[model samples]
Target: MKAVTIRTFGGPEGLAVIDVPVPAPAAGQVLIRNEAIGVGGVDAVIRRGTLAMYGFEEGHIPGSEVAGTVTAVGDGVDASWVGRRVWAFTGVGGGYVEHAIAAVEEVFPLPADLSAVDAVTLGSSGMVAHFGLAHAHFAPGESVLVRGAGGSLGIMTVQLAAHGGAGAVAVTTSSAERGDRLRKLGATHVLDRSGQGGGADAPAGYDVIIDIIAGADMPSFFAKLNPNGRMVAVGAVGGRPPADFGMAMMAAFQKSMSFATFSAATVSEPDRRAVRTAQFDAASRGELRTVVHELLPLEQAALAHRKMDAGEVFGRIVLTP
Candidate 1:
């Protein structure tokens, strides 16, 4: 089997594809003949050694989600699972190869109509977006704003909130071209984010704000929330927000506004499963669309990482082995 590994993590150049032995499924696990791999922002963070506590090694595979067919099942797994097409959360960072292993509890069978590309693309980002909408305290007919709306999670947030009955959906993107696409996806308003400084006025007073860019944009975004409105900061892609981020909240004290951050990384198993199931159901019904920016071969993991790090990928990047 071939897998992508990062021994000395720093840049995309260090993401190396190498031959490795196929891993066998242990108890409660299934072996997948992986057809597609989901590349996400967290994968990039792990690759950069920013979260070095994860203890990635020379042969550490760097993917988390995969869509594939089950070739075999380990002890305690149902024999009927073999040959079933499914999308799963790999136990470790081992989803980057031709074959992957996942715990049975982490696997979800995919409908025949779902392509592996779509399945992988809908993995983690979709889950986060689904849950973040709740953290926004979303309500039907309310105005919503999705910051960093060009990214995978942000894009889904825009779609879900739009479809969930938001009266007006707004999005912030780096280009007018990107904003135009977002408008087609359901955004009623598109704000050009390129060269737009933090705290820039962006048509204020949204009822719910989904912020994935929590750096310089925090203050302005925090101040724009309507009275009793909620802002959910899901990512810090631009960089960490300033330490005194509460200043905006203090100023908005009269509004009774609230700000919270969510990460699927810290979610419990049951909660993760519930959100993923809801996302899959929405995808199956065509209510939620999974967008794929690019599909590359497994060996091009480095290129995928580079594009992701540069914020050039508009949607999820799938890797085929």
Candidate 2:
């Protein structure tokens, strides 16, 4: 099988496509002939060797999610899974290939009407947005602000919050055109990437903040929360915040505001599967939106990463094999 692997660390130039042995499914796993693979921020992080401390090395495949047909199953997996269309979580690698392996528990059956690109787009990101809201104890009437709202995860947060009956759904994005596009997707207000309104005054404060960019500016967003507001940090694509970023919460002790980081990794397998299934169903039924920026051939994996690095991608980029 052919797979794209990181031959070295740093630039996307290091990504190379090469032939490799087809991996066999182990016990409780299934082999998928991948049709669509999701390219995410985590992939770029891995390619840059940012995860070196955690044992991510050169020659690693950097995709975490894929959607395709099951070719075979290992011991303990049901035979019925063969030839079934499904979405699978490939953990941190192995998904950027013609064939990928995933534990049976990580696979979910796709709706008949759902396309492979849509399946991969909403598979893992939808889980994060759904659980992140729950983690923050979000209430339907509360206002929401999704920071870094251009990518798949942020885009999911915006629509989910609006569909969940949020009073106001605000987003921070790069361009006015993109903001207008997001408005059609349920965003009530759009702020620039700096989290500031163009001319109109920003909302008094947000009741809940879904922050994907948690860097030095994190403290500023922390201050925008209303009383008893909760802020959930789901990604830190902008780099880490200051060492004393938490001090702002303490400084405004009377507000009862809170801050915490969240990841879908903390959720139980059953819970993750259930939520992902629901999201896929919702999308298939047209109750939820799945934004796919583009579908590229698997060999263009490096080009996909380059677009992500340049902030040119507006939504999920799917690679077809």
| Model 2 agreement with the true structure over 126-196: per-residue lDDT tens digits | 88999999999999989999999999999899989998999999999999999998998889999988788
Q: Model 2 has how many clashing residue pairs?
A: 0
C-alpha root-mean-square deviation, each candidate:
2.8, 1.2
What overall lDDT goes with each candidate model? 0.83, 0.91
Our tally of clashes for model 1 stands at: 0
Q: Give the TM-score of candidate 2.
A: 0.97
Question: TM-scores, in order shown?
Answer: 0.91, 0.97
Please estimate how well model 2 matches the true structure, expressed as its whole-model Cα lDDT.
0.91
Top TM-score prediction, candidate number:
2
Across residues 28-119, which tens digit of lDDT does each residue of candidate 1 receive?
99999999999977777677776667565554678989999999999999999998999999855888999999999999988778788888
Model 2: pairs clashing at backbone N, Cα or C within 3 Å = none
